[model samples]
Target chain A: MENRNGCKLVDLPESTRRKDRFSFTLLVVIIVLIPVLVESKYYLIVLNIIGLNTIVVVGLNLLIGFAGQISLGHAAFFGLGSYFSGILTANYGFPHWPAMVVAMLATGAIAYLIGYPALKLRGHYLVMATLGFGIIINILMGELEQFTGGHDGLIGIPPLSVGGLTFDNDLKNFYLIWAFVFFCMLVARNLLDSRVGRALRAIHGSEVAANSLGVNTSSYKVKVFVLSAMFASVSGSLYAHYITFISPSTYDFYYSIQVVTMVIVGGMGSLWGSLFGAAILSFISEALHVAKQYHIIAYGVFLSLILIFLPEGVLVGIQHFYQSKKLQRLIAVKTPFLLWFNRF
Target chain B: MSNSDSILELVNVSINFGGLQAINRLSFQVESGQIFALIGPNGAGKTTAINMITGIYPPAEGEIYFEGQVLSGKKPYQVTRMGIARTFQNIQVFQNMTVRENVMVGLHTRSRSEFVRCLLHTPMVRKEERMIRRRCNEILEFMGLASKAGLLAAGLPYGDQKKVEIARTLATEPRLLLLDEPAAGLNLQETHEMSHTILMIRETGVTVLLVAHNMDLVMGISDTITVLNYGEKIADGSPAEIQNSDKVVAAYLGREPW
Candidate 1:
């Protein structure tokens, strides 16, 4: 059968086509109903957290998944954003909105500066440079006590207000966070579908080929690096405003690893995969309250299980399974028909 | 041809890889709407010359002019924007992407829009996007790949991958197209088809520059043939002159002919 676009799915065996259609429908339904099902204030809080995490994961996805660049220091950008916004709002008396904007810009600028030298390094060297950047930020967060509020972390931050309305409660914050998350997802999707996204993917597949294709590979790399940094900064701004507090400990290397895990566990190079990954992992971390004592151990076990059984990640595995089932169904339906038709 | 008719002119181009000279003062002109062949034995710097012409490597000496515009210092993408597109000796399709998506990438240079237009799905952007897709489909159909548009490039057979690469280069709407070893892995029948395709591409007013080792295929379709050996040009003339050149035979055989 052909889809409305005149793209033929009949060429794909019946079982395979059926599964594809079913899974696509299922995905759409889930996306449409997620907000409606999240009714509880507590669950809404969880969703807001998911939204914040999704932003960082999407950024990390562009860097690691699309650009084929590994960054273990993204938390540096996150922490920098938080500190930048916290300082501006707390000391400069800037509004939270402008502070957030300034914070994102600051993070992007810093990323662009560091990317010039950091992007020159490849593979393990790149990892080292990023790790060094993270360590430096973490150290600065503590040492710059006069500006950053020291180890006690900045507190008593104001809520985000717009047009005489303040998002002071969990419900309001949930909508705000989710709106930002949706906007971010839209941006990420657009970037993935645009020329820049294609160039990034081409570089990921093979940088040499990408260069030959007339892509300025080095410049594109730096651009994605800065763009992803800005994305992480936005998430950081949301976190600071929502909690009304900030700490260096929160935006550590461990947090960066968590974000990377979310992207990888979702399915590298798949935007929807990153969302699924963020939701599943974040849910697991939150749901197992008793396992909080061994949260690290629990996280390790969960990640290990995902890596072993679903090496391509949960979303990719699900997609593969759906496709195979669809193919089986298509063959089952069409084999006899083909034989009868052949007799004619 | 006059200077205006010649889309790409490489004047005394030479590229040195460290101590080794890959292309030694090589010069040629690709007039618009002609198929020009560059043939050489293994390690004769055929790909190296194509690389320089396509902006992957800067010539150690010489100037490249495309449509009266100097292209020596320009980047590869800048060259592409100037309407020169090329394929690799090894098949270089974006393996993870579908064939249609791969072709769509070639259309990227031609697209005119900011990031905001794509994000908002503005009517104009959508219209332009649809037009590009339609054109991509047309190119695929011309290359006999309409049915496999949705297939991941890596899944396609070698011959089809080669065709997809050519189709992608065509999507750029280039004035000059360069093919590096297009018939490298093809069977005799496929090579015949490739020759026909090359002719078809030439008929479309796109200059063709083919680098190949297959003499029979090269002799069959090339309007002008240039032979290279040890980074130096050995022969430059019509296909019949190339076939009869003693220097060409000596270069291919590694010895002077009787």
Candidate 2:
């Protein structure tokens, strides 16, 4: 329930802090226990991909849910990160860690340049801009042969390593990827709870109102765009290293659509919804393998269903469902007393 | 050219929408601590004038000076930082946010911590956030919406939503506040409450400039009234003076002989 008093921070419920703590604790327990319980490399790999996707979806949610801006080209940013990190480390012999950082910064810079102009004008300009940008980058990834290794794809991307240890197998990479996922979620949560977060939600709620209140809406929009892009870049780099291979197809339009679907299905504005979205969608896609050619259609159907029934996404939808069920029970209990009182 | 007490001065300001002029040669001075009203029939460019003042649309001619700084090219947020804040005629409160969060947005210009600091939850940012929470509470309490702080703004009644918008603007600690129709859809009681709120805001030393169609509200509280018609100012004086002025009376109702 909400605080209802002016004493606490606005909009944030009293249990939110406790709930977040509990969720984080639960996540840690799951992360630590999953590998031991599952014992299958295939499942671990799937879980790792979900973790990587979670990071990007969470970042995308900030732009989509908080700023009410959409990017159909995030897959391009994802590609850029993979190609940058993969090409730099595998081809140029750069260290893996620095390559990842460089990839993120470069992606952030690119997002800024794109966001600065696109964000100035209101409405669906961003959607069009990102759509065009994603296609161009995906083309460049294939067309550039020497650097990217062409359609043959970039190979031999080194798994991340510390001084003496390396994440080469599925289980090790699982820990590595999910570790990043956990950290990314924490960062996103922090941003959401702070002043910047509120400014972002305000921009989403109404850009005019946000501007009137001294929010540099354009700048903040661009900043969040860059931040989300950087998040995608990190996930992309992890994806490249874990898979030990990179290709333009991996960051194609469908992948972008998939993650966007995840954002909506999980809950547009909910952080944990991003996780559930990525997990559920990724699992569905994997499970739909028998329908190979029809999987995209299946995704379309699933997306339509979610939009129709759970427009707020799965997280908030479930919340409303739970709340209403509780309310119904309370009313049912109170009806008998009301009927008796009516006779008087 | 304005005296030291002039908080905002519009000088020969005009704007055009394509070939049509929305406001023409309009000039007014709101002195410090005055409750000024700009009243006119619909489509008289009252909102357009407010837009120009708040830097939503720059005047095509002349300048708007806030504390002697030219506001022609400054962005809306820049005008806010310069201590000029405004509310929309149609309420523009952040519907998804809580009433307190809406007010917290008012502190955007005042609070210094940004993305990195807020993400890290740095000592300085935490300190600033604490200060912001305290200030938001004070604002909500002052506006008597403290009990509704945690409620989503979209869920509040229309009158309370109006108060939430004003409370949010107050959080900006603005020197000059432009309220566009502060009492538009309100009942008599709500309008009375709004007038009291405006007077209270003025008592705190903030200059109030409102655009309203409600003659009772404009007459009841305004220290000065400026009447506009067809994008031109027809009369300017105290409420009583404007009420008695032939031009002001003609603008509201057509000539009796006609």
Candidate 3:
């Protein structure tokens, strides 16, 4: 407290601070310039989809990557958001923005009820529990014809608007979705850098040690699970409003697995890895469309290849590669000179 | 000893694992500001007793009290918040986090911010964060780990890792500290340093409850020693008394022919 260095304890080291600032500025510049630079509407739509997926993946990263809680029923939360928003707006005459809020809250509550019991048990219990819940929700989406519109899907979900501006076009929604994505990333970075964030990583590192230090592992797990569900719910609501149409097939078991895969492909504990995972996987899935009937197999092969080569996900994997290469260069430059001196 | 001097009291506490009686109605008291040692051989329920006191496993019988509050049925975190902290036999530092961050986790109970406030980084949250960091730096400095504050906990030497474990628990500002095997794997010099560290920690006025097998380290630092065998308290007294006790020698130290 008396100030040995005169620097605050909360301040990151100078080098890491510089790097973090650089990356953050770069991200903002990309977000601001993309719409101006790209002229294609189709590309904008795809970018919007990437933004949507990035939001879910960021939240999922906090749960799975940082807090070490697995969630397989994120798709259920996603679907709940879509259905709740769709019914409340298209059928029940509620306003679009209010409907999305309700969707997120409802999904969070549902996740809490599930997580309270599931998180109390260790290991794959959460994985199995969420898997079953996701399947059940998917089935309900098909069977609940009255509210959900059944397998045929729901339409006429009014586009989200504020004041006089309506996000009715791909260009407008591109800004709309990316703004949400930017806010999600900002909040996530803030959380991850703070005391709460440290406790979460501690839980992931060793729950017993964390608990002994008063971190409350189970409660934190449940809280993160709920927060992740809320994130998925927000993404789902955004998707419903953006596309103006959705069906049971969109949010299913496969979608949950896909998002989970994105989290892994991004990196288990890396924040930027979440965004990279979403962008790269989304692009690969779209690119594989050229294979037509064999796209699934192509996608599977691509994922397997990435996993094999970059097991820690792309961002961390690349960082590790760069550092090791630098170390090799150092050895290459120093060892021979030391050997020559030894000969003398 | 009077109840006022006792910081921790285990009253006939018992636990079982299926057919095995891990701890059989063992009871003991740790006096305030004293270095108390629980010594026993392998499988003598030393670690089990520590787990029970920390609420990792609640006692199946009797009660454990800390500062006159019952710890039974409480969660481990709850027990920690009640001013009891512990370190593991196998060092349980958060390997991915820095040494400073590991100690910051020990200061978790002192802060009250939740996820929403943390995400937004409210002014109060920032203030608390700064306070937490300052405390972490102070603790690391005390433990002679300030220079390695940025290094990951996993990168530290084995002896340093153990010190980091103690530094982390100290951040909790515990009234009663439970150290499991503080000198189990240390070499002669490291063990000697550890003995001094324990005495130094006791000088800070924290009551220590240590579980150890090293007779020299235990006798050097501990004011009282309780010997256990087969999950029962075989002998309890001051180090000199236990060293001279016939029962302790027969059950633990082994007797010499007269």
TM-score of chain A of 1: 0.85
B1-258: candidate 2 lDDT, tens digit per residue: 777989889999999999888999999999998999999999999999999988899899998998888889888998899999999989998999999889999988889988988778789888888888888878888898877888999999999999999999999999999999999999999999999999999999999999999998899999998999989999899998998999878778877895
Residue-wise lDDT of candidate 1 within B16-135, one digit each (tens)? 988999999888887778899999899999999888988889899999888888989888888888888899998888897778778877787767755456656577766767777778
Give the least accurate 10-residue stretch of model 1 chain A, judged by summed lDDT. A8-17
Q: Candidate 3, residue B71: CA error in Å?
A: 1.7
Please provide TM-scores, in order, for all candidate models, with all chains considered together: 0.89, 0.96, 0.95
lDDT of model number 2: 0.91
lDDT of each residue in A225-314, candidate 1, tens digit only: 888899899998888888888988987888888888998899888887888999998898887777768888889888999899988889
Off by over 4 Å in 2: A1-14, A325-327, A330-344
Query: Candidate 1 at B88: error in angstroms?
Result: 0.4
* Interface residue Cα RMSD of candidate 3 after superposition: 2.8
lDDT order of candidates, top first? 2, 3, 1
Model 3 regions more than 4 Å off: A1-18, A325-344, B253-258
DockQ (Cα-based) for each candidate: 0.34, 0.59, 0.60
Please provide, for model 3 over A1-344, each residue's C-alpha lDDT reduced to its tens digit, 9 standing for 90 to 100: 54475554343433565776788889889988998999998889889989999999999999999998888888898889888998999999999898999999999999999999988988868998999999999999999998888999998889999999999999899889988988898888888878789999999999999999998898999998999899889999999999989899998887888888899898988888999999998988888789998988877887798889998998899889878978789889999999998998
Lowest summed lDDT window (length 10), candidate 2 chain A: A1-10
